[model samples]
Target: MKLINLISPSANLAELTALASDDDLLLLRQDAVYLVYQAALPFPGKVLALESDINWRNITLPAHIRAITDAEWVTLSANASQNLLWS
Candidate 1:
């Protein structure tokens, strides 16, 4: 199944990255957006950030990570077969 993982906490990226499978889609939100600047790329799958959260944080997003809208977030949630929330 295609899984969409919502990771909102600043910590746990490394552990989650190691645990995540290729079919998982990881979307980092809240404090997790800060990982874009660090070495925490959350690779092995599609890694995205919530644009609203990024704007609220006033963070300058790196070119590598794509930001998704609230509507898009809902769409992604609806499209996924299952969801894994890691906060």
Candidate 2:
């Protein structure tokens, strides 16, 4: 799956639009609304947003796209980092 990290205050929506493909994952957080609002792609893959983000009001996501928490992402990221480091 393709992962798009939306951690920038000024995320490029166009980048997501261009990167979106079947089975691509779009992770939204911080100021990601800048791009989430402009997402016109079908987003066949998952679109995950931070549960604590206030930007959710700016856009509408499909059922496939769900909200997650920063803690969850951190845990996942940490696990991935550990695996990479151990390897």
lDDT of each: 0.76, 0.56
Prediction RMSDs, each to the true structure = 2.1, 6.3
**Per-residue lDDT of 1-87 in model 1, one digit per residue for the tens?**
344455555556678778777877788787777777776575688788899989998988777778999999888888888777777
- lDDT for residue 78 in candidate 2, whole number 0-100: 56
Which candidate leads the pack in lDDT?
1
TM-score for all predictions? 0.80, 0.51
Q: Candidate 1: how many backbone clashes?
A: 0
Least accurate 10 contiguous residues by lDDT in model 1 = 1-10
Model 2 TM-score on a 0 to 1 scale = 0.51
